[model samples]
Target: MFYDSYLYLVDGSYLPTVAPTGLKTDLGCWKYHFGAIEGMRQNGWTLWTVILIRLVAEEFNFKLSIMGQGDNQMLLIEFTETLPEEVTVNQVNQFISALEEKLSYIGPPLKIEETWISKDYLLYGKFPIKNRVALTTSWKKNCRMFRCCNEDFPTIETSLSSLAANLYAAVASDNVTQPIFFLSISDGHNQQFSLFLVIYQ
Candidate 1:
């Protein structure tokens, strides 16, 4: 009589196992690589992103991290964690998207512009002998062109670096101590809401 078995190393412990012939460790596995965390800390992910990842992982019992690509000098995040109850995969994906969007907006202030329906145009007769009609009356018409304002504008910044820049400007210069512009898009108003950051120097 003989016994056929196998062994698996988990957390530095070699445990005997008698399971299927082919075992896929990638699926439904708790992969905890300290090196991955260190790599993310040194390179790709910010402190906020790391904190957010930890928070999300703790809240949802998910394991995710930024892994380095072999010899490519690039890093990527591998998300392989089950979400909480009633949460869809898209919601989990939105976490990554939000991080990326925030990172992209970190460099400079974002300018928001309002698009106005300026005028309408009408076409009459055949294509070969068509005449263009420009409507100037205060009546309903089709949209032809959009007019964007260039005078007053708004800007948005959400990172600490931007805050530092604003603070530095207030201390270093007097001309930059005026109203800082910002904007927000509101669905209720169906327009761009201009916001001003008044720094009293």
Candidate 2:
């Protein structure tokens, strides 16, 4: 027989014959690694990226984190959070655009990316320019520069770090805290909204 076949006794009778084909069992070792998480943790940082973006969503926060990156290409991001049901992917993108507009003072346009994370959305941003040293502090009274199109961005009242970490902790820890600065865009009075951000360096 050209093909292998099994023979078995049925009703006290021999069934069939078989060919000489055979199979081997040993399989070579497979090695897989995720250097991203390992490196981030070692560098005293972590990426809080979202894992999923669902169709019908409600009550959540969503953003990506690039932490302790030594260079531009090698970045580790972890997205984590949920959003209210009324918000859609398109609306989130619009909000991201607004943030880009607000941070225009930093220079270079922002390149945005949305990834899926645990039935939620993971928002990521890439600055067109690189090698910019970033410092995060609470809104210091001296460096506060916040305002809507109607009013100039007020000078920050806390260090950028303090403000940033507080926001991250609030969302990461699920504790709500009023943001120190809000941007209303084109108008400062009625359009204001608080936000938490993860800056890439």
Candidate 3:
């Protein structure tokens, strides 16, 4: 089963963090995931974990993290675990409190904006467009835009770095005169959404 959760910044200016769930593992097995976690920690980024619980006939628990400084940063971490059927609100609050306390030593205090417990979601992908005229002319003609699953997206750090590099390259080249921004479109059923990063002249 593939479990996923998205954390959107309330401001809507930055790309939301997408976390695909991973199997729960023990601390002794940290070597498997520690490299990525440690690299972010060493770079002075704060990590905040968000837990999403879905309750139906059975309870499904998904964990993901947000990393940043002050209020403008995000990252992804994934963990999957099952909660006891009889868990109570008090127990859940206690767990969250403990998690926040544990993470305080490493960086800023963990702030959880919200918890999403929904069964319906839209699978997201990315499609890049290089021509502005093609979008205005005909959607049918531009059907060949490159598309890939969300899991295939570069890490937030990598995406930002790449965007910065591209901006610098565009500035240095006299031939490049287009601006880039993302356009997200959802299907009528809202079951799937695609993000188009358009670079137009």
Candidate 4:
């Protein structure tokens, strides 16, 4: 759907090519331009509602933002839109539950916390292992797990790079006909997440 600043008012079924007149003269209109995702359900193309849940707070004129912190590590999302009225834990959980329902394939582990400042909430989330190249019916045992963290140098990037190279090396050594894969989770900083590299021969 194509729209100017009045995106909230546009009908979802309207095509982008049929943009109304004066659309080009509107200020801050370009920011509202959205493209349709190919696989989304019918009549459900809203960006915040369908994909980016973090920005949903904007619809209510509240503050919702994310940042990477803690020694250049860890992703933190803060929601601080509620004022005058108290924001309950149940409300936060309901919001998260809605997101989880939309993103169920993202795994089951999620952490949520509320700050003492009232109405401010923090959510810690992670992306699960995606089966990009193969079907992941179940996780196998005996997989090697590596943890490398807390370094004065660029440990996270180097570790991840080395992990990828090592997987290729292992595949070559074992003469495996199938593809070998590894999982990498980084908050883009000091903390190192669990890395599991498996070679299926």
**What lDDT score belongs to each candidate, Candidate 1 first?**
0.33, 0.32, 0.34, 0.39
Which window of ten consecutive residues has the lowest lDDT sum in model 3?
Answer: 49-58
In model 1, where do residues sit more than 4 Å from their true spots? 1-61, 70-88, 107-201
Model 3 Cα lDDT, one tens digit per residue, 120-170: 231112222232211121232223212332346544344444444444443
**For model 3, which pairs clash?**
none
Encode model 1's per-residue lDDT on 82-163: one tens digit a residue: 5443454554555545544554566211121311111122222111111343323211111111122232532333232334
User: TM-score per candidate, in order?
Assistant: 0.19, 0.19, 0.21, 0.22
Best candidate per TM-score, number? 4
Off by over 4 Å in 2: 1-64, 67-91, 112-201
Q: 74 in model 2: Cα distance from truth in Å?
A: 10
Ranking by TM-score: 4, 3, 1, 2
Ordered from best to worst lDDT, the candidate numbers read 4, 3, 1, 2
Which pairs of residues collide in candidate 4? 72-189
Candidate 4 residues 4-108, lDDT tens each? 444332455433333566344333334455764354433342332333455333343334444433211222334454533335455555556655554454422
Stretches of candidate 3 off by over 4 Å are 1-43, 46-84, 88-92, 114-201
- Give the Cα error of residue 30 in candidate 4, in Å: 46
